[model samples]
Target chain A: MAHVVGPEVVKYACTCGLLKSISSLYFCRYCCQLRCGFCVCHEVDSHFCGKCCENLPSSEARLKKNRCGNCYICPSCQQELSTRIGSKGPSNPEDPKSTPKKMYYLSCLYCRWSSRDVGIPDQSAATGGWPDRENVNANRLQEIIEMYKAMVLAEKQQKEKDKKKQRGKYLSYTDRTGVTAAALRKRIGLPVDIQHSLLKAKPKEPEPAIAKEDVEDLPEELLTKPVNLTEVTTIEQRLLQIDLQPTTVEKLFPVHKQLSIKRSLRCRSCEHNVSKPEYNPNSVKFKIQLFAYYHVPEIRIVTVEPLRAGRPSELIIKFTNPTQHQTTITILSLVLSGDENEVKEETGDQPSLPQEKQPPSLSSQPSSLLSLSSRQPSITIKPRPVSQEVNADVAIPSSKVILPPRDDAAEYDDSGDTHNIQDDPKLVVWRKSNKAFVKLLVTPKQGLALNTEIVAGFTMQHIYTNTIATTVENREPDKHDHNIRVFLTLGNLVGFD
Target chain B: MSRNSIKILQGALVCEESKLRGDITIGTGTIIHPSATILAEAGPIIIGDCCLIEEQVKIIHRLPFDQQDKENTPVLIIGSHNVFEVDCHVEAPKIGNYNVFESKSFVGNKVTVTNGCIIGAGCKVTQEQILKENVIIYGHDCHMREGLDRPGLQTLQMETLSKMLPNYHHIRKPNKKN
Candidate 1:
């Protein structure tokens, strides 16, 4: 969360080979891998009007062309228009007791544009009854769609008739009688046209569009009249109408407000939702959010000395364990080539190794059968090699740094250190509840020009405790070390002091 | 040049907490709310009938930069049925009938507001220009557009405030007799 303000100094490599901050990555529990936005599948969960907060179903939204029915935006400024009431004076001047009639018109309170400005009459009712323009070519388009539907239906029926002819080859009762089905039907006193009547009527083919050689020439008035920019509509304004793109400002009409959508992300491999928002557009809460910041430890750069070419610089980085379990951190050398070997092993060994390792009794258990039937087979995508260039070498520390579990009560208590834990004083500079600062020595590569950005890389291996119980017998938490490649962009090299 | 002169005609209701200074004349059937200020720095201010000035409104009549040294000073006259909404600041030299200065609106001294004009809420009009009849200035960008009809009067709101304000606050007595 500290990286939300400034430039990204620390980046973690996702399983899909994209480098991103911890706040932007999602950790999938089923796959046990970090997923980025590029690798996950995104789907629109709901469509809602941003102004009215009214949610619309997908089918109804499609019917309205994905625009709100009641809301409208100003054609000039694109702001929401409010309906205002205008009172008309008495129609009969001699009638003293007559009351004024109220009429409503859509007006933009922001831009002061009203429906009356475009010569539109006011409406008696508030909601709806506004004039809606239809496309001039709508009838032609409808004819084309109906023609295509009929053509497809005719093609399908012809294919079925061909299949029926092929099936009648082995059954030769008609051939033995030296008569076809139509002749046998006639001899049996049934109607010869019964088959045609039984099938549905076939539609006639529609006329195709005709291309004419004569094109309309440019208007003669363009040569005499001076162009006014305000009267002519811009490209953006014309595109807003989409179907009827008016070129003049007077022809512009109020546009229906477009609907916004809420999206949900799913892990591609396991098909589990990584993030799913609530159905209600007003509710800001999420049903399931597997953010990597909640599952993995976060790393941030605390301080770094001025980096010079080929000179060693002291860099202090802070690591916070966000989990409830005590974790151990071990620093390893950055390996750019080892990822290819690991990917080869994963694809080559996964299929045969699972079948040979399971015992007969273990596979026959009722719980195992239940789990096997419920779980879908995962399709693991091949991991790409890390593409970071390490221009500086980091001295990997040998001792592992241990971080205590986070405590809610320890934050309030002002008492000094109570737990006695041994630590490597040289490597660990400072320690607090669930957080530790580690010291590292980085040496930039020599022969680099001045002002070149120095970027260092490393491998962070941390022990993760999986508390999820996959089987009835194994209730204990599984402790395993997970590795993530981290890269830090140290500031540009300064002149030698 | 008396600095604290205020003239309230018959049937005008001016709250005691309202700050008035320098040759200001309020017409009949006008209502001035508490904490509203009217200052005539270089000239006199004559407000017409049936006007409603709400709380925290400031109306100042100061001379322009070119006309500061003239012996004959022009008076800032605001016509009848005009509503000055809450927290508006009006420094316009002239405002005609049926004009509305909406809440938190600022009208600089350089602009002249004509009849049936509306300066919308939170609109700041500082450019030196003249607003034509029935012109509406609104939005964050100060967009100007011609309106078809003038805004309605707030007689009901004026009646309610006039009845309620006299009970709890002091009032300035009318000086002009009929």
Candidate 2:
């Protein structure tokens, strides 16, 4: 038995107890709060067109330019954009009566401003975006040279420290041949006596250039003889430590992360929001209303066939929408039997059936019936009136409100069988929809327990929004451990369960 | 530890909780005060071993907030055998080895001071950031705690060390001072 309560009897409590709602309610999953629209603050970081929203990688979204390659910008203003809303306001800034089209806008790299202020009538804005533009600064080359020089100096200091030597001296052939006495003395800051000693020890001589004919003539006899030049060389070749010059100090800059924003729905009246205005979760429009009084529902298992040699069999469900309006119902997934577990093990040893060789049209599943038309036509059984069995078979009024399947529902399959429905073994059915009647009859697979969640009294939107709120509430740290066992029983579908 | 043998180089004041790992090169007469920490969490800290480290120089090596769990642990390893004068703070959880920390210098958290890095005295490095392979940083001469917590407004006076130091593995012209 149930009792009806007045609106005053219901205390105003948000999904999270931080706030109260008298008339309407809404829930935010990210923040885990039930905030009134007026209380929440919205911030838009980066505005992007529809194409980038669908194609661009998340890493690329953080860049200053939102447009990808194979797109061009507006020729007049050199801005990348896409035309979205059209013909909404006044045309000219000065003229009062002229009508205007609310057009798309893009940012300018040079000016750091958008091109929406000056109406450019960009035809390419509909199909094009920014392309690769050349950088004009020429001084960038000079800066790079200075950077390379500094790197060389740091490496030399590290080598000396690693060797653990007190007075290690290293030199190259370039240093011995190219360095002049005066320049070497000035660079190393050696004393005048040492500088003179270095010059005196070196032999001042340049080899004479021989003509091509002379080399050809002398090569036969003179090339065979080894000439001893050690006696003519007065100074011994010595290695000196090269004094590395330290680079000038340069400033560093801090790094920041970039964020991107997307718009789903726009308002026609005031462009203040420019995107989807979130609705109150408790409103009637937001709710899922079920009208079950007019139609009859049936679940027909059209086909059942074996897949692997000894594994669990595949079952196909053919649900017919006999009513005039299209019926939307939820399939609470399928379950397998314990007895079939032995058969599943033997099938694993054998190689999987080659599914790719089949034709494209028949590639979905080999076990299930082709479509609803291929199965038997609608068989309408006479409705049973007033009986205890009828009351038990059909669930009472106001049971469940179904919402559109969430996006992350695909992660429900831990195995890669999310797309293939033949993998499941057990199937559950709902007895009633929003307090509407439900009837189930003979089917091949039986002995399954059905959990009929009878939702007392709530709008369609409230139930769906509450379902989302409940999921977020369980994700809190303290409740997460307890929820994990419940979530595992429901499988990988984290959002709904 | 002879009084006349060790020289006091450049470094900042540090805390007592500091831990030093790997091969560290400290300049003569550098002072390392109490409470400053250093963890050669990664490879080694190869200071020129001759440079001075001042007192209270906090040099630490710990991972940054974003890359902590994803990447390897902080390694404060130095190789530049620089001097540590009195009151120098040095903390590098992950030091690669061979980097030099001047007196009165401060470094904390996953700061990879690779070989050949020269940190000036009185310099404070906070925020789990990267100092790359070969980089040079000059400390602000005035105060040790100026502009420490201002987000996005921090002025980091750093330059590419490659421009000043030679590539450790490459065959190129060495620094004139070496």
Candidate 3:
């Protein structure tokens, strides 16, 4: 429940200043920075129908205007319409053995809306041949489109002719209109101007559309008859047919369900996909998942004492190491003012690579860049300073807490403590496999009002083990101290009786 | 509350363990589970034919607050083909034919239920309103939708329950001969 529907008491500050739960954040291994949905580039991976789960190619999806061809939704209720079979009387009633012909029609189970209500004929076959509504002004619209195409082509040819004129060593009079060149040739006693029979004729141009002042009068029956709301279409029902927007229920028709797309999120800075789903829609698996819950240490508030003004309260927080490698966590004072950051300092100190946040060093940079050449260059959003105000001051412990790597076998075993390790009695309250509960003292700001919300923040530095080999010689994983600012909403302050 | 008077008609299958109070009449082809409770507080509860009263179902025949002072005893008449699912509480004044009270649902005394209505699972409806035929009350918000046809009857489920129930538990013999 805490992983899904639990209240977000602990929030980790993302690179974009927004505080999000660790479950929603992505940890980019290359940049070693936490990225949220706001600071990532989302690209569509595939398009598929939600109902049929039939995957459509990008080109085919574009041709169908991103709507599923086979499946349709009810115009009234916006639910998927199922094909129901209707029995029609056999034409050959004289024969006793003939079975009744079956016809298929669309019907909505929830609302009991049938296609016959809108005068749609039942189809003999199931899949295709449903009549598409022809636009009333199709011919006129076609003429207008043709006229614009010709006009644009004519303008392009004229521009090319002007460029040729600039390159001419000797200017000719015929270049002005072509009539001047032909008339000049006729005046010079040239035999009737030999002409190329295959020359194209002048492009056709249609008349411009004119606005009409006349409007259709309202129907007389609307004023006389009592209107039934159910008979009239609702706003949502009308909006389903974006182009038509039919007002009457009679005009409503079944709409093809819109296609859903599977999107892959890429880290804005390093151009690496943080999360990518499997190609099949049915598979609930991911190809690459860099969720912060999996990579970073998950901090959960176990319990906190009653908060009072200027009083030190005991706060116990449990930290779970989800990664395969063991890491040490040190509680640091949160630097709310972004004047100095630990990430920038770590990059500056490294003598091998001077570039900051660019982890694809000499070994793995070239191939990744080549594959992403077709995609647009992702814009690097600037990191914003953490905005959460720490109203309560936390007593930072000098001692670092070490957590064991996650083990699947240890989770099932209910036996007593197998690995005995020395822990600081003052800070570490409890310890188990890959998890440790640490104690901290928190004091609300002095002269705080009664029942004021107390928010406390602290910077946690954990050594992150990068398993990705940056060089050929690097067989052992390189560990770097990654800093994450976590804020806890420790409820409202209470008054001392 | 009066002394228990349960009248089981012909072809009715009622478990002996069921709690029946104050002049309750169960009609033909009805199946009553062992743990169902039917309380007739102010009047007699006349349940019609082919009604399924599952376990933990409470059917109370108590009058509403406004109508409680009146001396006239209103007979709570449940029409034919009604289903009272497990853990549902029904105190409706009138229930027409082919109505389904789903599991854990509560139908207050003020709501008048007509024919072919379905009160969805876990839905609590207390407001005074008449439910029309083929009306379905569903979801957390109790959204209403009018279905074109009545919800299909649970004939197959009732048949299975009737055959399987007699094997496991003691059934009350139908007392009414005619």
| Candidate of highest lDDT | 3
The better candidate by TM-score, 1 or 2, is 1
Per-residue C-alpha lDDT of model 3 across residues A1-497, encoded as one tens digit per residue:
34572589899998777899888899988778788999888877778899999877665575578999999998877889999888888746898678888889998765557787788999998874677787677778767766665666666678987775345322321123233334556568664312321133445556777899998899899999998554677787888987788987788888999999888888766567899888787876999999998999999899999999999999999999999999999999987866245334222333344343346442464655665443323464556778787899999998999999999889788995576678889999999999999999999999999999999999999999888877777787878888888999999999997
> Candidate 1 has which clashing residue pairs, if any?
none
Worst 10 residues of 1 chain A by lDDT: A168-177
Tens-digit per-residue lDDT, A1-497, candidate 1: 54472478788888777788888899876555678898787777877798888877665565578899989998877888888988877756689778777789998876567898788889988885889988998888767766666666677678987775333212322123244444566678785433333344665455777999999998988888887554676676788887888888777778899998887888765566889888788998899998888778889899999998888999999999888899999999988765653364334333333342222223344655665532332445577777877789898998999988777777888895576779898799998888899999999999888898898999888877766666767777767667788889887888897
| Higher-DockQ candidate of 1 and 3 | 1
**The TM-score obtained for chain B of candidate 2 when compared with the true chain B:** 0.40
> Order of all candidates by lDDT, from best down to worst?
3, 1, 2
Q: Model 2: how far is A346 from its true place, Å?
A: 44
User: Model 3: how far is A211 from its true place, Å?
Assistant: 5.7
Q: What is the TM-score of chain B in candidate 3?
A: 0.98
- lDDT for each residue of candidate 2 in B9-60, tens digit (9 for 90 to 100): 3432122233444433343222233433434443344343222333344444
Error of 2 at A290 (Å): 20
Flag regions of model 3 displaced more than 4 Å.
A1-5, A84-229, A246-252, A339-377, A418-420, B17-19, B54-56, B84-88, B102-105, B120-124, B138-145
DockQ, cand. 3: 0.20
